[model samples]
Target: MTAVEFDAPAGLTGRGAGVPLSRWAAQWGMAVLRLLRSTLFVGIPVVLIATIITYGLGALTDTNPAAQVLGETATPADIDRMNHYFGLDRPLVVQYLSWLGHALTGDLGRSYYTTLPVTDSISQALPVNLSITLLAVLIAVLLGGALGIGAALSGGGWFDRGVTLLCSAASTVPPFVIGIGLIVLFSVTVPILPSGGYVPFSEDPGRWLRFAILPAIALAVEGAVAIARQLRTSLVGELRENYVTGADVRGLTKLRVVFGHALRNAAGPAITVLGYSIPQIIGAMVVAEAVFNLPGLGKLSLDAAGKGDIPVIQGVLVTMIGLVVVSNLLVNAALLRLTPHARRQQP
Candidate 1:
């Protein structure tokens, strides 16, 4: 008898193989393209519809843009002249098309109140809102994840009961109410942090953090409670699955079985909870920003709406819609990375 030997293919033999690298590259490229296509498919129609509604709102209202710009003392002739200058005399379809074109090109028009470009106001205010929101989200994720994991590991003990009770109580309280309480406790009682007012990070990072902490905490409370509840439930369920038993039987350490296996499996619903919380956080910012005296987009929109500053209002709303869309895109990308099922189902 003759013994025969065969060599394995290069791709099967090593991580350095060209075929595997090319296959990985192709998969990543396809995933990115699909993500982009999905974003555009959803974003374009949403923006178009939102813009149409926002533009039509001005026409529906009794308030005239010209009157808003020119003030109460302006004569009818003056208002008419101003309207013509703004091309408001044109057909609705024409006006909308023109505005859409300019918006697409990054021109949101001048504010009727300030006579400054709407983009300028949004640009100045967007950072403050983003800072507060991002900080709040970070705080929520970290604190919530910790509490949830701890409670799950506690196995229906005192810690789990306490966390559940805390979440229930916290969920009932509004962000503004929490903001006021934080102000009393941290700002007034201890006198360590400022009660209100935003400092730009560029001007002073320390002061910016000082001013941001309270409002961020207030905004974080609701999200934290929500995440805690969701994650605890998911983790508890995951820990009971047959796979966990298999891991234990394989002699995997308790910590490894819980975190490395169970946590990852349980994270999908928690991620979804986090993603849905973002828009709620944005909405809550109106009260949070007002409470904190932060000159953010919420305040900008509120002030603009009260004064009938249509252009500014439109700009702020559209900017918010864009933010929501972007956040959802990020969430989708994160899911693709974390969830095997999502990756398998990807187009």
Candidate 2:
């Protein structure tokens, strides 16, 4: 009989565990540092370049010049005052630096058309836009995801075929066209809902939902169809995996196996698609706002364009860019959190 003994390393009781723990902590710290550096190094420069371009374009397209073209009501002195007021009289580089500095300090300047603080304008309008967009997205996600689940489960039966057809039809129609059609049907002929304008949720909280319902539906249709298609594809892929087959073999209820197990696992990629959809939804805001005549940021931006109001245009552009950048960053962060594989990667 032979006796076998295993030798342990000195100072290694629980030390190996501490090593991996420390390594993980250091990795997370480096990730945070890289994020901050990227924001400062890459994002700052992009913001600077965007500011310069926007400011230059603002100066070039000012109401002063266009007003001059239209035979100005204001005298040369008044025009000069206006230019100075907007910092348009400065050298382009200086103007950019000054604007960038103000921006970093939370100063977005005034609306050229309204002569009101840009911040005030945004504060007044953003809520309405945000409300409408959020409602639309919620509707899209619920309806789309359910339809996708049904379609995937049916696997090309009549119900799946019908859903696919509906989505295809929806994807073909432009949001603006949808808005107009809904307005004609519901607002003009049926007279069931308001065609345009916003009623603050506080003013008549009940009316707010009805007022937004039509436009929200119109706005949501395209997004819903797109989301549904993506979800269905992902669900189908997930269903074919071995784990799902094993679940099916275990005598689990079909609904539980599909919804609880397969569908949830498939949701990761679908959520990523939904994240990218945020910007597209924002882009739709412009058309939806104009068509609905909603008192929202989109309408404000468009009015600025019509008047060639440089300050307002610049403010709107900066706000939209900020939204897009923030949305992308947040989506990436959420994805990284949800996907464990992403967080463990080398920088």
Candidate 3:
């Protein structure tokens, strides 16, 4: 592969020197297509395998799905009739095919536990999960990014040492442990914040904050540490660059040059890492939600699994996989924006 350069086009050239707008656009388009293609090739099979494993686990562990639906003490005839109606009597491959076909059409069938449509269950659960994850990510990124930049600017001062020590400890502690600590501190010791639970923000914003604070912090801690450490490294390296020094020598205030100029260049790789790390937030939410007793997708999936609610379980798995795929796409595009210099130019 050749590293070629072309003259910048119009308004885009000024943002970064000699970045050819046309070439950048083409490269970005190709990156998107490649990401989509690769994701489909990998994601589809993984989803199918996950479905097979989930369904198989249920079949092995759950002696009777029909009994769960129709009542455990129901007569054999009713159980048989229920099984027949639910197509639980069919072979594994046949049942999987039927389910897959319906899934392709955006129909995940009905829940075995509640007998409600699977989409309805997801609709009810998805918002809670989204709220927790989004809030956590926002808090982590802002606070962590600030700490990282501050540490870099201060070099080896007390501030830098403090950030290093704090982020190190926070990173070492797992999210579930953090949740437990928060519960112990806030709920038991101080008696200020609610230990854990969910209240819809639409219904009562005040109560919702009380419930949301601990969980969000617990969920954000590890991620914040993650972003801070990675970003601190990037910023430390950027601060010593010629351009940064030049800006500093040009009579720009220390604060202005370090933050305004140095931080932007440093942020590219940090943001790229942050983008790739978003899924960790989602993964941590499972532990956070369960620990907090929140009725989010994590808890819902656990309940569905225990009850052999195959539809809901499958729906949740697929939804999570879709989120990961979409997050990766967004992150890739964002990475391009952040590190525009990384874009290749074709001769």
Candidate 4:
């Protein structure tokens, strides 16, 4: 080839490669910054709102503040001293502001029930709650997805009707009722499983699984049923889409046509349902935890609320609100990423 032609082709190829590289670099940079904004910027306002509501309610209430700092025999002076010590004497707004300031810095204050720092207790307990929640979500997604896909493929036939009816029956029952039923069935009649109560997995792996299995299953039923129905509907919709028809006409196997070609497209609507399900799942976990006596966040929050433990209650609320907010943001981001049309419209 001539030197001129060679140089021209090389230049053109290099420029083409550079364009995509520059575009990708820009996209990557934007994604990183967006994540940071999502985590720190967006999360802060939500936490503040939670703080305002939590501390605001705490101030207006006449609940025992943080496990009675004053002794039974303490005089008025001692009570005053105690109030001053815990900043209970301060104005409501001022106290909230102080709490807000400390909270923003990750200082969740002291717990009345535990005499331990609120931050420490939450830090220890959070992993447990988070682990349970995650496991439950995992279970829901897998089993729910399977049941949903199977039902959709069966198309209201025997398998489909049975699965759908089973989920309906399960969902109709409350978590506590289900937990009690399972406990009675397994622990009373069958004597196969422990009745209730948590054991550290580290202490005894077998007991941990045995105890957690029923609670996790009980907690998952609602989400599982909901997700499954949504998935079945979504899959049906996907199957109706023209693209799915085109795929089938192209001679793809039924399994490939259904799963490989259609399932991903089916996931878009299901994702939305999953997004909404987050809070509901957490609420369900409360009863499930109570029934099982699992020391997860649900039980902790209940204990906090029952005793009017402001610090613990605030801590739990903030954590859950933060989780939900972040989850929602993530869902939005994922949806936008998955559906290019949405991202293109956003600056």
Clashing pairs counted in every model: 0, 0, 0, 0
Candidate 2: which stretches are off by over 4 Å? 1-49, 62-74, 345-347
TM-score of 4: 0.82
Q: Which residue segments of model 4 deviate by more than 4 Å?
A: 1-46, 63-67, 202-205, 330-342, 345-347
* lDDT top scorer: 1
lDDT of 3 at 300: 82
In terms of lDDT, which candidate is stronger, 2 or 4? 2
Per-residue lDDT of model 2, residues 1-347, tens digit only: 33333322211122223457777566556766655565557556666677678767766753464344335577777777766776767787887677667877888877655568888888788888778878888888898899999999889899899999999888899989999999999999999999998898878878999888888888888778877898899889878876666666666688887776676666667677777777788888888888998888888877777777656667777777677667666665655544434444655
Residue clash pairs of candidate 4? none
Compute the lDDT of residue 10 as modeled in candidate 2: 18
Write model 4 residue lDDT over 186-205, tens digit each, in one string.
99999989877777767887
lDDT of 3 at 320: 88
Q: Write the per-residue lDDT of candidate 3 for residues 28-76, one digit (tens) a residue.
A: 6776676577678877898889889877876777468888777757999
Per-residue error for 270 in candidate 1, Å, reads 0.5
| Candidate 1 lDDT by residue in tens digits, 267-300 | 7788889988888888899899889899999899
Scored by lDDT, model 2 comes in at: 0.74
TM-score of each: 0.88, 0.82, 0.88, 0.82
lDDT of 4 at 62: 76
Question: Ten consecutive residues with minimal summed lDDT in candidate 3?
Answer: 5-14
